[model samples]
Target: MDFDTIRNHYGILIVLSTFISRIIFNGFCWSYGTVIVQLKKQHLNISDTELSLIGSIGQSFGGLLAPLILFLARRYGYQLTFICSLLTCVISLFISSLIHNLHWLLITYSLPYGFANAAIFILGTLICGHYYPVNQHIKHISIMCIISTGFPIGYHIMSAWVFSSIEKNEWQIMKRHLAFIELIATCILGPIFTMKYSSNIPLEYQRPSITVTQNNNNRKSRFSLPIIVWLIGIFTTMSAVNNFLLHLESYLKYLGFASARADLWFRLHGLFDALFRLSIPLFIHLYPVNIIYLFPTCVFTGFIFLLLVFGLLYTSINALAILPIVLFSFTSAVTTSLQYTVSNQLFDKDETEQGYIYHVIITSLGLILGPIIGGSFLDLTGNYKSIMLISLMFLLISFISFSLTILLSNKKEDTHQSEQN
Candidate 1:
């Protein structure tokens, strides 16, 4: 695994291409919350809970389909898998744009579109991992995060320019336009994957050993109970974030901000999110802190900030919303990046893929639940404050669970050392 050769051959082109593809994919998937808000305003018959269910169904279905997509990637290669997925997305979006019935929209948007987006994301991640050197995996993951800052950036762009420009009742027109843009982008970028260099370089290039270990018992199964507990923490924390993102715009509207103004705040939140992710690699390069310590600290801090946001909402203080948004965005950004890095640290290469699958499944559960719970709270209370309170509780539980994981890990290390003595 010659690092220089791989770097020279592919350079940044691969990263840029994948970034563009992800931006296109996430731009639509993540921005659907804003679209849903618009849709609800125009189609007064559909309840918030129903709309949230549609979004949840898409995310949960995507999770359910991830293993199959991974298998397809393994069998047919990422290029072909991506092409097929993108085609499905294009068709799904087109169909969704024409739908007036909520049930029909659910079938087209929630199932095929969501599945394709998840497939593209997972395959893109695996492809990126394959291309980079073993030693540079963290750097690779960070860069991918930095590129994924595009997710929020894309949201901001769409919210500020595209969604804001449209008439309140013409949300479907916007969906149709988005479908056209996605169709063109897919056609142009899908073929790039067909090139020979697009395939993974080779398995031999992977690192010979794990870089991080919890104890002398390196033979421990990646699926051990401790790891499972840690994953539960991950799942809970991700659910909190997903819930926050889904409801943030609507919450702002509930707070009485105009749609355009609410979107501006959303865009600002994304800017901070991008900054946090982009700074992670540089922070590691400079500090070289132990991730085990750093990861939990970030999680706990974000939850605390979330508590503050809840307090602010309770007080009806609109001017200081930015503070919590920045805090939450920073926490969300770190969690998203570290989930990959920590997974790599915890598992052997052979087991990493399985770990990712489990992570996605757990995350999908959170994604599914976040909306339903939030929507239910909204429907029952006619406000988002209760949702915030629930999210705070979720984060608190995750913090305790992760803290226990660290403690148990240390206990295992102590036992391992005593046994050797």
Candidate 2:
């Protein structure tokens, strides 16, 4: 193929490679849930709490390492960062298969693998920045949303398929397969991603505009009001979702819903979440939204439906509660799925990597704090409604933060336009 033809298709190739990377990352990360079932059945002696530590530790370390991951990626460049991290993930998974002991597996299997996932994931965003010029990054968000859906796809579908029909005694085999799948996927995309970073690129390929470069020079402007507010918005949004999902089944049981019915909606939430993420490019195509405003609009809409669901629960109108739940699920899905895109718009094109790194770091807090706060409220008040209230509280805060982001982002845009004129 000619250079222009390869250049023309390079963006799609990058999206596809990143998409596959996301699938492998989440597929392996969440495989622990399925792995736990077999583990519990086999060990019989291990407490659920102890078994739970495996996934939790992995996720915690995975998320907490974002800053360091950024440091390395920036220092070593994407080519080395992606390859080394991918290898680390594959090797960790392979080593995990050899150890049957839960304690060692906690350290051996999940921790390094999770860190590698974070490195690959963070670097993926940075590398994609190279392909799409800074001005066009907003458009990049569309494909990125398509890519983001890979998480749910992995969580809901890939993990199950990996374990499907495997004997209870064969989980070691499952880990090996997970390693192989990731390794193979990396190999397939290695050439494409290799061309994406570090070597053959022009020096002036991705320099930021003078205005944005000026803004970046000031650390305070880098963390300007709008961006800080958006950070707050993301934190609350994630906390609310995690808080709600962590206890949804229990809350339904407390409200007298059948176990089977609750399971259906709970699973439906994930299914619908993925579907909505898939629909994002179409939604953008039809609506032509300015993501600056759309981001807040979505969070607000979701907050409204979520509140309606809570109201239905309190009014003894539980029959219609699931309706709002489904609607909330849609908005929740869109907001979370488009978050990375929205974050891209929050900063100058050249500064997006730092913005994204901060975005991931803040999100990890929501993940940890959400469940803890929800569980605490439930335990303290002996009321499941308390959990709902906490979720609502965070959701509302997220909406407000996003709205403020809209106002501040617009103000910054207006200022820049005025200065140019």
Candidate 3:
């Protein structure tokens, strides 16, 4: 089919593409924590600390290697790269099911799985940017976000079932069962969703800069160390926020709230996440286009939320515990939408997709650090306050880093325009 045919049926095609990919991405998001527990259980020698280290290793590698994968997607079509990534994850998960040895598990299963997760992140963003109209960029991203919520949502539900099965059956058997189920799901759905549209061009046609010429590729050299540092710091802050949100239940209980009541607060957190995902675009239309100012405002508000959560330990507000948690959810939603939107503004059309891959990898690494460090602080001091403090520091750093990114971005833009003159 020609571009016109696909464009004529754009609505249906975009929806299908977004839905399947988002479902797959969110499934892995949920699987991240699930695998941590399973890996620990399967390996007798791996302590909680070691498990954390393993996760960190996977995260770091994924962040660093994501650019290369994005480069590949820029060569092959996005659709093909996405299918390959889904298949790769299924294969890794299957191998993980069979591997009893720790060394083999880490080398083959865990590391690859982590890398595959990075691939999915790249694929999802690129696919969205490639297939949808550029003018509708934020709308498409928000639509994906709407679909992406299914990832965490499905993860929670499916993991519950998996855990129940794990309790009843041997670990190996449970692993095999889940693996086959995932494999079948990917094998059937991956091909169907990917091949549906024939007009999809090779990555070369889509993004020729990477291989266009040596000089052209030079323009795409990696960011400077200082910039990389800034990106990493922003990622670390986002990671801390992710950790606090994920562990809000334990944080509340530590602050003297009842387990049931604390759990209720967490459910509300999920509700706000879904609501924010749905609502951000609506709000985005009304917001000023001052990406510079608006982006920092999100950082500031999110930072304040982090502080409130941390302060709760000392103040222990029984009447208003729910408010900060709600703010946390809102902040995550807004920050997430803004992150993509700001990233969209920062890079050109050709550069935006790959930049997104880099961003996700960095952000995922931050996520890895957040929980590991948060858990350590809790285990060492028997308090959640330290975690909150760490989160606050990370967010402050993010606020600064984002400010620098904008400054650097604007300076670069001005320099380019002057040279053109």
Candidate 4:
């Protein structure tokens, strides 16, 4: 738990390995909308709803498989789980590139590939959580979030340089190229995960040991009314954000921007997302503010900004779309980091696995619903404005839920202190 320990050689290696692995895994996952859009234009006869369903189904399946992956990680170790995930990803991407039929593509990319994505992401989070001490968890997690921005960074750069330059017919080759890159990344970082230093030490060394009575109290508090409200907030926030992200490019296109321009806007969104994530750790350190309060504040502010921008766009001021992009990026970064750090704060060290499992399940529900709902709006109205409104409603629900949770948690704390007196 010492500061010096966190700055040691192995610590640096763990950070570097996690950075590379996350970039490879998330880069492809986030880039799916662009790929799907291209596929719909060229080869697929599917409607917007159906295409969105692909990602939803894939994510839902991945969530369903998380417990099994977690089990394997416990029994066989993270190294094997990571290796299998990487191989599955590579094979799935390769198969996706070669497949001519939509159903086969879904079978390969949406099912096994989705499972691989979740396994890799969850494993990375668990690994990083284990590698750092409790005191350093937020800082390290923020660093991981910064590293994860590489997904969008790589996606944007590649779209601008590689995908845009290629003929429209050759867009599928991007998937094959991604497969090759993942193979190389796995080959390089996979060995680092197998190193003995990557294993998690017992919680006693990581944090102060809790007595039985305190443990019981912590367990009770972990699932109390406030925590349930917070979980609901997290679920709604994730769904709202994913709905925006999944359809942002398509929305831009609908707004009359060219495909290339839309891609650039997407990249711009990534840039701001990374910046906000990088800034959060510093912000938390400088201010004596509670993240539970800060999180919902950001969500509410972003939601309001999005509503204003959407209103402006509806009035034919299309150029102001950049405002919502920036707001959404910042809010998404805050919520994403808080979701991990808050879970850490709420649960006992030994119970984090269970806490994270619940987190994943809730997050997966959002992932599954976001796109389906957004796409359904698109189908129903044949317009992007309605979808934007729906996303705003989701964010509003999240903001209210989180605000109530914070208030109830404060009330509970007050009651506990009164009892002690």
Candidate 5:
């Protein structure tokens, strides 16, 4: 077959690579809370608060470093870097299985695993962007959503399997099983497919003609103006706020909910998050992209839902708690997915690596800060109500920020059309 035909067939490989890679990463991502429990059990001297702190530290490190990994991928080949990341996680998992001390776990496994998780999260999106055409971004992102949604499912399965095995005194077997699965799925598949599909042409050659750099000095001047910076701040805060909802399960359990019920609520949140993420492309097709308004607007409403949940607004049924989780998760997926799509479109295809990196830096900022801010506040009050309110305020700011971005983009488009006329 001709090269175009080969590329067409290669799309399946792209999807498969993404699917397996996500599953491996998802295993680690969702395993945090479950493993935190195990660590507590293994080190009985460690307090619950201390375990939460360790997890927070690990996640904070991961979020902060995620963009740096993508930056390195820009210099080195993403294909090579991604493969190395997968292997790193595999090695970490194996070593973690052999150790018992908390300090040793933090240094050898926790730190490396944090890097592994960050690399996977950022590179998954980068790979999807690399292989797919700009027009196909939404479709491709939808596929990513489907694969990513399986993360929570994997989390539950792994948690159950590990806990059950440990109960049966089969810790070694379970650890080895997880290690082999992550290794084969990510370390093996990534290099083979990436080497096969990654382009030989450098990213600079194919990027968009317009650049943030050209606008950088102008952008800096503009930043001094309050409105533009305000918008960026609002957008950043909104991103962070939405992220807070993702960790609600831990927050709720800390608030006195039963562990089983809390986990169930968390999964329910994922189900909604996944469904909304998966459906967005279809929704974008049926409705104007402006229909994105509904998501943030619902977010504004969901804050009220949180208050109700926290203040005994409802009967306190298990299903009732699931409501806010569902709403927040759904909105989170929309914003997260939309941010990637919008960033991909901002520059020409040739500049996507930089564009993707730039947008992700914006995303990474929120990821790094959200937990620190939210977790600190939760610790201070032991009540999530204040945090929910803070999140609600940020969502409002985000709504305004997005609205302004749309306005600015529209103005630019109009000016270009008039110039052509």
Candidate 6:
């Protein structure tokens, strides 16, 4: 009947909390394409690459600061860490709304906002599985899958709803809108996470942030052949994917689609992505975390890239464009969802943390590089099709990287078995 009673059975709250954080993070990060277009109009003199850095710079900082985030979470509990980070996020967004200068926006908006979103999303999702019993395989996996779906779902919500509601020149209002979202999330979710551990949550959920002490003997080197190839695959794939996500709105405009239609297509693309991610519950039930399966996901993504490239080759690009966009979003969602679990399968039990940290770094590097490269290319050629071609190449490289990972990991296993024999 009371708040404590509600806190005791907080599984739904955890889901909602993590889900909303995902929306804010993914929506803002991925939908920066909308943000960049607005900024470009206001600052006609500023280069695209420079404006792109507003989002890219934040991602790089977030990835680079993963260790610090870990330390903070451990030292101060996930609840406190999330609260502080989101608070900073609220402040950052508010301050950024007032700033018109590009440099100041980069410093105020991107850096702290990126850092805060990373902290909240990482810490929030990290404890997600803790809510379910270890024996509840489906429950655990399904919860995570459901939570992860929030990313693209938010992407669509932001692109379609927020952009369509605000005029193109209303960049200032957009930042405040985002800040208010963060504020509401902070106010609501912060207290929910701050609840006592003895509530109806699982035993593993007793402490939001368990101390992972230094164990040099337990530290697995991430430089293994499989990991290197794995990182390479991820790096290349995200470089293309993030670039596409960041610039799709602009690219659609370039393709002769009206702004409303562009927003509609953009939202639909992300909707397809979110809808496809719903399969993760069934997927985890059938195959679990089979790293080998990721190879096909990458190949499919690359295949979609090829289709997208082919789609752009004609003047009647619009006639055939929607199909590839739908397919691309679907395949991309599958690949992106599996990325975290794949790292767990690739590394030893102890190495998941290290591998994940490395994973975040590599992913951030890709996100950072994507906008810069994509922006420069777009600036030079004034074409979005070229972006597709380059993205296709990146996907191809990722496919090859994943191939090497599978082959080398298998070969290493065989060699070890032969020696034992």
For TM-score, candidate 4 versus 5, the one ahead is 4
Could you give me the TM-score of model 2 versus the true structure? 0.77
Candidate with the larger TM-score of 2 and 6: 6
Please list the residue runs of candidate 1 whose C-alpha ends up more than 4 Å from where it truly belongs after superposition: 1-7, 198-220, 314-316
C-alpha lDDT score of every prediction, in listed order: 0.72, 0.69, 0.60, 0.73, 0.59, 0.71
Candidate number achieving the greatest lDDT relative to the actual structure: 4
How displaced is residue 33 in candidate 5, in Å?
A: 2.1
lDDT of 6: 0.71
- The collision pairs in model 2 are none
Poorest 10 consecutive residues of model 4 by lDDT? 198-207
lDDT over C-alpha atoms for residue 158 of model 6 = 75
- What is the per-residue lDDT of model 2 for residues 1-421, given as tens digits with 9 covering 90 to 100? 8766666587778778887877777545644554665676689776544554565445445667787876666566666778888888889989988986877987787678767876777667666656654456446666666667666665556554544634443888877887888788777766667544332342332347557656547577567888788889888887787667656655676787865576556556656677777777777778787756665666677778888888888786677887777666665566656555665567665566666768888876776577667766666686878878888889889888988877777787799999999
By summed lDDT, which 10 consecutive residues of candidate 5 come out lowest? 221-230
Arrange candidates by lDDT, descending.
Answer: 4, 1, 6, 2, 3, 5
Q: Cα lDDT for residue 187, model 3?
A: 63
Predicted candidate 4 versus true structure: per-residue lDDT over 1-421, tens digit per residue: 8545644567667667766765667666766777766767775458888788786665455865677877878777778888888899899888887877776777878888888877877777677677664457556656556655655565555555444534444755877777888899889888877535644542222235668897678678678887788888878887887788778778877777888777777778877777777777778777757676777888898798788767766666777877777767877777765555567655666566667777777887887788889899888998888778888988899998989988887887799999999
Instruction: List the candidate 5 regions with Cα displacement exceeding 4 Å.
Output: 38-53, 56-63, 66-68, 74-76, 103-105, 137-141, 147-177, 198-247, 254-256, 290-298, 301-305, 311-318, 345-350, 384-390, 411-421
User: Which candidate do you rate higher for TM-score, 3 or 4?
Assistant: 4
Shift of residue 250 alpha carbon in model 6, Å: 0.9
Q: Residues 279-347, candidate 5, lDDT per residue (tens digit)? A: 776876676565435544545565566555555523556456667656766555655555445544445
Better of 5 and 6 by TM-score: 6
lDDT of 3 by residue, 1-421 (tens): 8766775376455456555554544444443444555555566565444455455544344556776786776666566776776776677767776766766766765577667766765565555455553467566655656655554444444445555666578655765676677677666655544424534443453435455575355355446543574576568666766667545554565567764465456556655666766776666667635544555666778888767655654664555756776777665665554455455555555455555666776777776777677767766775667667777877788778777766776787799999999
Better of 2 and 3 by lDDT: 2
Clashes of each: 0, 0, 3, 0, 5, 0
